[model samples]
Target: LRILCNYAFNYLNIHKIYCKTDNQYAARLYEKVGFSHEGTLHEHAFHYGKYIDKFVYGLLSRDYLKK
Candidate 1:
């Protein structure tokens, strides 16, 4: 994932990179790559007959460039 983010920021020349996950472990992993908790969509999805929360995470290209 870090490799992908690097390519997206460096080669693709994107302005921002984002990720959304319902799992806490995945969120922590994204945080390691400079993504931050941008927002959350409460109960936006359903799983196993129950509503699930969606977490949004993002990082800006300028921030990456500064690193």
Candidate 2:
């Protein structure tokens, strides 16, 4: 994932990236990839017959470049 992010930020020249994921597993992965939690939308998504919170994660190209 880190390699992929590097390629996207470098070769692709993307300045910012955003993602929405379930509250559980995505936290660690996002942190590992240097993405910060921007915010959460309460009950913004529905899955398995229930509403779930969606977390917003983002990373900036400049910040990734410094690593």
| Candidate achieving the largest TM-score | 1
Q: What is the C-alpha lDDT of each candidate?
A: 0.90, 0.89
Q: List the residue pairs that clash in candidate 1.
A: none
Candidate 2 lDDT, tens digit per residue, 1-67? 7988888999999999889888567788998879999999999988999999989999999988998
Residue pairs in clash, model 2: none
Model 2 TM-score (2 dp):
0.91
Per-model TM-score on C-alpha atoms: 0.93, 0.91
- Model 2 local distance difference test score: 0.89
- The parts of candidate 2 lying over 4 Å away from their true place are none
Error of 1 at 21 (Å): 0.6
Best lDDT goes to which candidate?
1
Q: Candidate 1 regions off by >4 Å?
A: none
Question: For model 2, where is the 10-residue window of minimal lDDT?
Answer: 22-31
